[model samples]
Target chain A: MTGPRIALAVLWKDIRLDLRTRDRLGHMAVFSALVVVLLSIALPTPTAETRPWLPVLLWVVLLFASLLGLTRSLQTETEEGALAVLTLAPCDRGWVFLGKGAANLIALLGIEVWTAGLFSVFLGLAWGPALPEAIWAGLLGGVGLAALGTMLTTMATSARFREFLLPVLLFPLALPVLVIASRATAEALDGRSVPGLWWGALALYDWVFVVIPYLTFDYLLED
Target chain B: MSAVETQEVEKRYGPVRALRDVSFSVPEGTVTLVAGPNGAGKSTLLRILACLTRPTSGLIRILGRDPFRKDGPALRSELGWLGPEPGLYADLTVEENLAFVARLHGSDSGRVESVLEELGLAAMRHRRARTLSQGYRRRTGLARALLHQPRILLLDEPWNGLDEEASERLTKVLQRHRARGGTVLVAAHAVPAARELADQVLRLEQGVLRMLPGGPREETHG
Candidate 1:
């Protein structure tokens, strides 16, 4: 009925749909844990010297895991011709984009909440005065990710190697989210003072970068 | 009320022109079947009207509101569309899928169950969309298009994959809607159900749209 109400409806449908069979959160959790294990073994951080690196590494792994989920939506969108149905609706295509972005942002945040908690415990990483700061970092990262991921996923539906294309294309667009998340995370985890500039920097990228994807999403969804 | 109007509508993909100087108007509350061979721009015209595709050039309005002014959602609040092979989320049960769209349009989920029951889809409420046959899935799309009680309905190839019963059901629904002063536009592969229901027929070919000579007449296409 209302704009946000419509968005929530889409989000609920996606969540309920995912819950019945695939378990998006569970899949992301497992994938994230696997990445965490791999990172732990690959880097040889026996003395906890790589502790500051924990925040960044885990976030990177989680980012990949979220991408894994985002990439998977392509098959469903194509098979269902959901894009066609969505485009054909009397509502604005931007609402469709925004609805999807909000859904993805929430889902990614769900994964981050769980993965961050477990990752901290396993990595023996401590969050000091920057504990709350690290979370804001995570939220910004998730917001930026949802904006770009939905835009690209719309394109990947038209592509042949969508899964491969998502990460390959995303690797560049996502560098900003990565740099900000990791730097703020590194500062927070190491018990260093979180810089005022980094927060502003992440927020700037969030607003500025999102506008491009938001304004252009409808074109990508079209034939 | 005029249901739709387009002036100098042209859509192009780079150098190729898909729609050329398409100007047309349809009287309100009529079943205007857009018929043509493949690549006749029928689908393109429907997309522009549905506000899904923007014309590379021209002015168009749905119920008199400019559809391409970047204020589309405002216009979309009252529009309904059924695309060819409208895909539902495979993992969702039929009921869940229905309720989801209903609520998305700010309607009640209970109405979804009732609508499904009315459409004889009650028993399969828990069934996944991927599990339904082609005909039933199209029914799901039809149900969603009918949600929100839209004043305008745009269906692209509405009769594909339907059996006699489903076809009859859809015809009845359209007849009821038309009787209520609602406007219906159908892009059908063949003439559907009763010939008496159409107020006008349109033939699309070679990037042009024109009215068929006979009003609401039966057309037998081989």
Candidate 2:
């Protein structure tokens, strides 16, 4: 199979597995949504002045929730020893990373959408003209997060304490993505223009992560 | 040329060495049995040969190509590997799992059916792997490994969960594969069926590999 075809096959398998089990995506949606609801109840009602914190809260929730989806995606491979089969497939193993990242991009987008809706409902914030730009930022941010998450998660799979190690390794490497994404999001939510610098950082982070994983995925699979 | 060749292969995890200076070769059209006690590096050796694991320091050539090189994927395509874990997606049906793997190999649907029937798993094709018995699950992995018609087979414990009939079927399959000039490297216990089929027997203990004299039929593990 060609690279794209192999990647699509892997994506199809992941989608099929999720469809049948509903294990990872369900956990991600519920865990993230719960964070929003719990915070809404715990925090004081937001006014125009304090509402910028909502964007930060939203990114935080989505960030941690993404951890669950990312880890589980590779966890299934390790738990079932399917990683061997994937690495053995007649294609660049990076294709597996691409397929995984794509699947995660889809799942994270779903979580982000629901979380955004819930954020608006709970915080009583009006999206207004910022909605489109915010959506754009979120999409861009998702690509970077998904790409980085896919690579780090695979690295953590062979770790002794994968559960704890994944976050430690991911959170540090993910800081740049989180910082840029959150700032752009805050600017959009505050009805200010997002700087080109922020958007450029997000795009650059996404491209670097996507390319690095493709180049280095073979080493991660190697023993 | 040999289907598999390894020279001074060693694998290390932290301070522990799983394989040490392991070297062996399996020429074409023969079945080589790798016998070892648990934790004796059988799985690690097989993993290296299958290109799923790279040795810390060594040379490995599968089908005369270095699996660590750029053409590794193409080399892997010509090799079939079954690890100790069954290596299947439990949520997928037997047929779905087989079909998905076949597609990854760029094979058509017809190959899937033939493998299913060959393993006597045709009737259970639609059943989810999680619902099947252990034997059936192993058969599913075996079928997937064989579906692409690889030139070399690297199987780790192919008989561990199989029933007598299924074991017989696998033996026959190996015999046929060898008759057609395919190479097989099997890591297994000293089962009679596997022993009878092996042209060579290797024993591994404490990260060392030794060739047993008198071939598989006459060799006995201590």
Which whole-number lDDT from 0 to 100 does residue B10 have in model 1? 93
**CAPRI docking class of candidate 2:** medium
How far does residue A81 in candidate 1 sit from its true spot (Å)? 2.7
Highest TM-score against the true fold, candidate: 2
Kindly report, for each predicted structure in the order presented, the TM-score of its chain A compared with the true chain A. 0.90, 0.96
In model 1, what are the clashing residue pairs, if there are any? A1-B106, A80-B87, A90-B76
Which candidate leads the pack in lDDT? 2
* 10 residues in a row with least lDDT, candidate 2 chain B: B213-222
Model 1 complex DockQ against the native: 0.51
lDDT of 2 by residue, B92-158 (tens): 8999988889888898889999999999999999998889998998999999899999999999999
As a TM-score, model 2 comes out at 0.96
lDDT of 1 by residue, A1-223 (tens): 4656665666676666566666666678789887776765676654656566677676788778878778666566677766665664445556667778887888899888877777766666666566787889889888888888888888787677877889998878888888889888888766777789888888888786567766775676666
Task: Give lDDT per model, in order.
Answer: 0.75, 0.86
- TM-score of model 1 (first chain only): 0.90
